[model samples]
Target: MRYIASQIGRSIRIVALSLPLADARDVSQWLGCNANASFNFHPSVRPLPLSLHIQGFNISHAASRFAAMTKPIYNAVVRHAGSKPCAVFVPSRRWARLLAADLLALAAAQKRPGRFLHARPDLVQPFLKRLSDKVRNYVIPAQNRVPSY
Candidate 1:
C-alpha cells in the first residue's frame, strides 16, 4: 500500500493505523507522508480512553510473586471494572486456575462470594461433573461460584 501510494504521487492520500513504534517517523517518511500528514499517537491514546495501573513485586520466587499479585489483581478488577465485563490474562492455564481460586477466596472473604461468578449453576453443574477428578477436586467446592468465561 505504501509503494502504491508513493507511485500515485500527490494525487492520492494515504492513511495508516499502526501500533506505536519507535520508527514511526521513518515509516511516515517511507509512506511519503509529510510532517503535517503524519501522526504517531502514544499507545495509551485511545478513542474510549483506558486506565492502566502497573505494580512490580520484588519477590524472587515465581510462586510467591504470583501469590502476592492475586490480591492486587482482585482489587484492581473491583475498582476498575465494577459491574462491567473484564478479562484477566495469565501466562499458563495453571496460573489462570490458581489466580481464579485466589480471587474467589478474596471475594468470599469480603462477603461477596459470588460477585465474579455466573449465576447459572444449572448450566454449569453438568459441565463440572464431566471434568476430570483432579479438576473436579479444585472446582467442586466453588461450583456455585464458577467464574464466567
Candidate 2:
C-alpha cells in the first residue's frame, strides 16, 4: 500500500491502490484515476472494492512463500493428529460434488457409514481427465522444457 505522486495538481485527488500480488505493470491502470476536481471519486477502482484489496486475501496471495512447508497445516489437522481417525479424506467424488448427504455423513459419525443424503452412486458422473497425458508428460518431467506462457 505504497503511495506515489503521479501528477502536478493535488486539487482533484483520487487515489487508487491495486492488489500487491498484481503484476507491477498493472499498477498504473489500477491507480489510474480520473483526476478532475469537478468530478470527484474515492481512491479505489471499479469492480474491486477497497476493503477487498486493502484488507483481504489479496495481500497474502501475492506474498512470496519461498521454501516454506505448506501441507503441514492440513496434515496436522487430520493425519498427524495422534488419534485413530474415523473418516476418510473425502473420496474424490464427495470432495467435488457438494451433496447434502455427503455433508451430513462427513459431520456426524452415526449418520456417516450407512445413511447418506445422496445415496445413488449412478446419479453422479465423475470428472473426466482435464489435463491430457501429453500435457501431463510435458509438465511432469522436471528436466523437459515446458514452454512458459
Candidate 3:
C-alpha cells in the first residue's frame, strides 16, 4: 500500500497514517511530502496511551534465548490477558510449537493445566481428527486435556 501511494503524483494530495517509525522523515520525502506537510511524532505521542514492554536476554545462542523467554512470555500473558483472548507471535512454526508446549507446562505447574486449551473440545475434536498425523501428534494430547478456563 505504501509503495502504491508513493508512486502517486504530487498533484494528488496524499494523506497517510502509520505507526511511529524511525525513518518517518525519509518516508515522507519518498511520498513527495514537503517539510510543512510531513509530520513526525514521537512514539509516546498518541491519543490512546499504549504500553509496550521490551525484554532482552544476554544468552548468545538462539535456542537458549528462546527457552529463556518462555517463562517471561507466560508471566506476561497471565498478568495482562485477564479473561481476554491473547495471541503470541514467534519467529518460526517450530518455535511456536515449542513455546506452546512450554506455556502449557508452565500453566500446569501453576495448577491451571488447561488455561490455554479450548473450553469445548467436543466442538473442536472433528477438526482436530481431520488434521494430518504430524500436526495431530502435536495437538491431540493437548486438546484432549480438560480446559478450566
Query: Which candidate comes out best when scored by TM-score?
Result: 3
Full-model lDDT for every candidate: 0.71, 0.32, 0.70
lDDT of 3 by residue, 28-66 (tens): 888777889988778788765444555678999998899
Q: In candidate 1, residue 30 scores what lDDT?
A: 77
TM accuracy, model 3: 0.53
Tell me the tens digit of each residue's lDDT in model 2 across 7-101.
44343445444333334434444555333322323436535342211111223432222112123222333343323332223335634232323
TM-score of each: 0.52, 0.18, 0.53
Q: Cα miss at 110, model 1 (Å)?
A: 1.7
TM-score-wise, the better of 1 and 3 is 3
Candidate 1 lDDT by residue in tens digits, 1-149: 76665577644677677655557889888776788889888757756544555667799999878988899999989998886666676779999977877786777678776677554555656686565555544443554545535
Candidates arranged by TM-score, highest first: 3, 1, 2
lDDT-superior candidate, 1 or 2: 1
Best by lDDT: 1
lDDT of 2 at 93: 63
Q: Which regions in candidate 1 have their CA more than 4 angstroms from the true location?
A: 1-50, 130-149
Shift of residue 84 alpha carbon in model 3, Å: 1.6
lDDT of residue 112 for candidate 1:
74
Clashing pairs in 3: none
Candidate 2 displacement at residue 90 in angstroms: 24
